[model samples]
Target: MAQLRYIYSMPVERIVRYFNDNGFHVNKATANGLLSKTADMFENLYTALGRAVLEDNYISCDETYYKVMDRTGNPDALNINKEYIWAMFAMNLNLAYYFYENGSSRGDVIHKKLEKYKGTVQSNGYAPYKSLRGEILRVSCFQHCKRKFLDLQGNPDADKIIELINRLYQQEHKHCIGADEWTQEDNLKWRRKYSKDIMKALKVALKRIISSPEYPPKSQMYTAANYMLGEWKGLENIFSSGIYKLDTNTIERLNRYISLSRRNSLFFVSHRGAERGAIFYSLACSCRLGGINSFEYLSDVINKAASLPPDTSLEKYRNLLPDKWSKK
Candidate 1:
């Protein structure tokens, strides 16, 4: 019931009424308790998911804001502070992990979380992402670059840039038609054969626009060109591996569920409450990615957790992961 409420973005009051109308006669307090306890039951599984994502060789990352209510004051008073929820997605494994850090979005927070991670991280050109340890290779999102020029549609230079970008997307679309059957090496060869020339042309066009005096330094076209040039190396890294995506669109789409929940629930009553939401979101989104029914997955796992000993091994908990559980 709690999973359904959150997954569907139905508020607790509505969920409670739904049960009462169906003759279950449950109250709001009972519903809230069920939701909290259910999240607690899945805490261990959430940790295992995080470890899996961090250990993977490639992942995408993004963050969104949530309003966390301040619990240090009067209960009736409105004391909301803006907090961030960070998401990390392992594409190859079909797993998603979410985390909260006392509402901090600092560079050190990222460094602390990913200090030992030695893999490619895909994200937008967030400044903090650039400060990641030398071991981590950062990949910039093309959609972000396109959006900058997309906003300046009236300019001829912006139009030309858009045309070139569309051509690149067209090549990607063609490659994607039977992408599932292609090996990583096959993908690499395809991109080298097709995408290499388009990217070279894009670089040349960006350089031409940057040198032209018609577009002022402060103009949107100039800024967009400079932005692409600055991220040119990271953008070019797409050719480095076929596993990397052209954009962080996968994780960005995953983040919309968090946005939807926030729109419905408004603010969590405490930091712990926000943490609980993170756990549920992680599992639910992973299940959705794996094409599993979240309610069945959660229900079975919660029951399995109840049957297991408190001192169960980490391997046992890992077996309950979405992908592993789906195979059963």
Candidate 2:
């Protein structure tokens, strides 16, 4: 299992060639079987880990495009949509899982999948999770919130926007740093003061954008301006809540793996394949982050899933979690 995990984490050609060359020297049929099974095994391994996730954790999610070959055609290639990610939160601090699918994810898709999530979720200005209402507290990623003003940094008119956003960040970072000895309650209170600062900036930015010649409804900056306008409320959610740190760096860090894997492998065969890939990537990536040997984790899980009794199958899996493994 460890070997497979290691290979999946490797370049696709490397994985294919390793099996193909090594397989030919041994037995053709068996080697071909190994080669064919590589992607699928990886798919299952990821599903196992993703299913093992818990519900109470805060999650950060985002989607990116994956381009793949169209299986239905001959001599013609088309870009098929796959997943960039389906990440979950393990703790308040770390990214637990990242699932990569090969299609475009809409707001409804995100909403349906996350319906059971009970904790707060942090994301950029994606619309899917926007309308969902429940125990889930929604927070906007601060980095994205600041991006508009950051873009406006040289425009002079947007200088106030930049100043306010930066000030909020500086305030939070400073307070958190100086607050090493403070209680959680005090920390929450310490940060609450900046809630209005974000609103102030937003209002000012909006008025300027609306009155300017670049209102976006008819300008080249339309998409950027429109996205910011649509996401203003979500972005402001950060200050209203104390638990959320102002950035989606947690999930964006998860995006780095997506960037890595996709940069090399190209795309998936189908959306279904993409979905499974997402699950696998999530588990495998999480394993790497926790310093767990991903192959060992996958191999053990696959073997155990086949033979273990239902009652003990899951417990056995949990026992092997990286955090748990560390204690043993």
Candidate number of the best lDDT = 1
Misplaced by over 4 Å in model 1 are 73-76, 177-181
lDDT per residue, candidate 1, 210-261, as tens digits? Answer: 8999888988788999999888888888778877898999999889988887
> All candidates' lDDT scores?
0.85, 0.59
Query: Per-residue error at 246 for model 1, in Å?
Result: 0.6
Error of 1 at 264 (Å): 1.9
Give the per-residue lDDT of model 2 (tens digit) for 186-228.
Answer: 6578677755766676676666676676554765344445666
Q: What is the TM-score of each candidate against the true structure?
A: 0.94, 0.76
* lDDT, residue 79, candidate 1: 87
